[model samples]
Target: MTLSRALAIAGFVVAGLALLAVEWAARRPDSRVPTLGAVVALVMRYDVGGLPVGRLAILLFWFWLGWHFLAR
Candidate 1:
């Protein structure tokens, strides 16, 4: 794959890991870190794809939906 595609995949993997870490942190009471981490993950997922167009559009749509709910 091209460098761009590889980076995109890497971004997705990293975001997934971050989201998991946030969930783990969320289990701890009084921790706001989880919420912050989850938001970062959502933003990265939105940004690494760069824009909402073509295949990215479909992916961004779902990402935005998740962000809308989870980010709140």
Candidate 2:
């Protein structure tokens, strides 16, 4: 596969792990993993251009942690 595709996949994986980390961390004081996941999703959806930001957004939702369900 192309490097860009590989990186995009990797980025998605990292972002996913970051989300999970944040969620699990939320069970304690250093609840940075969940927040970090939201941040990653936000950053990925920030219109980076030709970098699979869309893919990141999609993957970020896979966890369904509902990190943004109450904001409306």
Candidate 3:
């Protein structure tokens, strides 16, 4: 296989492993790893002058990511 294709496959494998790890951690009650909802709540708590800057920033990031990588 070409080097780029191999690298892409490796990247996907790593991402999948990371997702699995997160799922496992979130499922374990005694695990120190914070759940996705907790992380989002923490981020959403940040604000600037009564505006939810963190939430807005996350929304913008998701929009940009979807537009660039997921859109056909």
Best by TM-score: 3
lDDT score for residue 5 of model 1: 87
lDDT of 2: 0.70
Q: Which residue pairs show collisions in model 1?
A: none
**Prediction RMSDs, each to the true structure:** 11.8, 12.3, 2.3
TM-score each candidate: 0.43, 0.40, 0.71
How much is the lDDT of residue 63 in candidate 2?
Answer: 47
In order, candidate lDDTs are: 0.73, 0.70, 0.89
Which window of 10 residues has the lowest lDDT sum in candidate 1?
A: 46-55
lDDT of 2 by residue, 7-71 (tens): 98899899989877767777677554455556666766765656877667767786464665444
Evaluated at residue 64, the lDDT of candidate 2 is 60
Model 1's alpha-carbon lDDT is 0.73
